[model samples]
Target chain A: MKNFWVTLGALVAVGLAVALACYRWHCDEPLHAAARQRDALAWLTAEYHLRPEQAAAIGRLHAAYALRCAEHCMAIGEARGAVAQAEREGRPASELAAARDRVAARERVCREAIELHLREVASQMSPEDGARYLGEFLPRVAAYRHEGAPTVRLNQ
Target chain B: MMNHTNDPFSEALADWRVNPPRDPSFRAGVWARVEALRREPWAAYVRRHALTSGLALLAVVAVGGWVGMRQAHARADRDRALLVQVYLSEIDSRLVATDGTP
Candidate 1:
């Protein structure tokens, strides 16, 4: 009986070892590393295989774009507030329409600026990498709903 | 006892003798029965069927490893997609608009 239990325990240990080995073998190490990274720029640099100069250029572009995006966000927020205020005050249809249009216009400005910035960043990579990068991101930009930060919807 | 040998009954009793048929394998047969009745230990039974037991263990380990690999791969893919989404959201603000109305 003791021998049987020992053999059973040995088999279980072997199975566990095999399972752990297989899990480690199949896990995507690079992707896991990228997921652990908190910095988007660092992730992008590693994922896209960007050179030092390219990373620096994209970094600068990102900084500049971030400021522009913040400004656009502020403008869009104000426009939306105006639209809400118009509604609350029972303003004329024309005034409400104008406020809504301002919000839409701000959103369009922000979207187009982001699209341009993405293109600029892509241009810094090798032609093939740039095209690949654009392929991955351009659709998200086109599909932006101005709800918040853009996300890749896996279901879609 | 002095004159009983002359009597008929005493003569028959004196002539009586016992005889039985011989079996050459009788002792061997009894030993075979003893061996058949003996209980075998579980460990010994497994050792006796080692090939079958080893094959079963191998199959179990293989299936377990395959399942582990598939689950790990699926989880990794999900994490990768989530990380990509997070990275995109960090860079692009349009998807997360503050206002409910776009």
Candidate 2:
């Protein structure tokens, strides 16, 4: 019986040691996010030859833009939901068309705001670099903009 | 009873009973040897197996570091992909110019 207790205690101590090691080394979400953010800024700096100040400014702009985007996305989602609901209920053609038009108008507004924001970002770079960056970057964002509409419950 | 002295097994038993002259500490000596064998400290045991232990530790650290690096790399890739999406959200000027007036 005493041997059994001793063996059990030894096993428990070893288990605790391994658990502590894992806790010390494991990555958490916020740290991971921060690292990625740093990597993205680094990528921009390398790609555009951005000065330190430009990198900082662009990073801040992106952060703010992300917040604005969330808001715009939420609004767009609501408009899309209304359109979907109208269609599902077999509303009159005119009402459905009006809902569709409302979504389109809101989308146009979102697009304009986005373009203005891009211009602000580009202002930090040389004219050639800015134009090239915008040309390359805009299309990727556009691809996903409408991709999620069908799958996502945008209203929520 | 046949003549007891004539039986070889009886004679041998009688001789052993008369000459029971062995070490009484035999059992104690055996146990002491076992304790000596089992009482080494863990540090000493590890030192004795240093090469094997070091290799095992190295293997663990190498594998753990690799997994951590892969996870970090994957996370950065995902974030970069997201940044591309964010930048693209600006939409092509052509689309903005041709689509509905805001």
Candidate 3:
């Protein structure tokens, strides 16, 4: 009887986990922007006879955007490194601040480019699809909720 | 309502429309391909079996750990409660004995 109860308890625990996962994923309430992008691409190709060249071109532009973002990310890293070096040498972190400004400038450019790309995408996609894409990305820039919290929300 | 014909996906797709990119002849160069895609589609890359299995394994281990912690807590509480009950019973008997002596 004790063993039977233990087994029953285990089953119940597993059931609760499954329920939690279902609730968290929202039973399909969650949006799939990636899947939507693929669909849009396929539809564009099939509907408009968009040459592979054209599709590839847009893909390239996106790639350029990614590189720019990466550069900004790298700049931020370099700036932080400079600050660490300064601290070790008992010097002011003024050099780090200058590096930070460089990163900030690069990031600003990346943001403008992202906006331009978004404008192009909005012009190409349906209103609903545009909404879904924006919904996925805009939350990445949300302000901090608490101290020491990591702020990456591309899943929204 | 449970039939496939009434699926929500159907409704979503039915309302779908497209606005083709203005420049259809554009082609991404080698650099773009290397940097952006870096691999296959993002979905394909992320859906690797290794990653999926790793995440599932981590989740299972976490649940097991949580369950172990809860059982330990329950055991500790049970032991504490039993000790308190035994102490109270002994005190009650001594009080009865003293009442008779008085």
Which one is best on lDDT? 1
Q: Between candidates 1 and 3, which one is better according to lDDT?
A: 1
Better of 1 and 2 by DockQ: 1
| Best of the candidates, DockQ | 1
Fraction of native Cα contacts reproduced by each candidate: 0.45, 0.02, 0.00
Q: What are the runs in model 1 whose C-alpha is more than 4 Å off? A: A1-8, A145-156, B1-47, B100-102
lDDT of 3 by residue, A1-156 (tens): 343344346546765675465444432211222123323344333333345775566556555655655554555455455555655666756765775565456445545555566556444545665566445433432211211221121122
| Ten-residue stretch with the least lDDT total in model 2 chain B | B93-102
Better of 1 and 3 by DockQ: 1
Candidate 2 lDDT over residue span B1-102, tens digit each: 578868899888877855577999999999997786477666665676678656755665555556565665565555555545333533322222222222
Every model's TM-score: 0.68, 0.43, 0.32
Clashing pairs in 2: A141-B88
Spell out the clash pairs found in candidate 1: A147-B96, A147-B97, A148-B95, A148-B96, A148-B97, A149-B96
* DockQ in order: 0.23, 0.08, 0.01
For each model, chain A TM-score? Answer: 0.78, 0.62, 0.45
Question: What tens-digit string does per-residue lDDT give for candidate 2 at A13-117?
Answer: 554555445544554444345335545556666657788999899988878877777667666777777888887889999998998888778777777767677
The sequence of per-residue lDDT tens digits that candidate 3 reaches over residues B10-91 is 8899889998877643455656666654545544544544565456556765675566556545544433333322222221
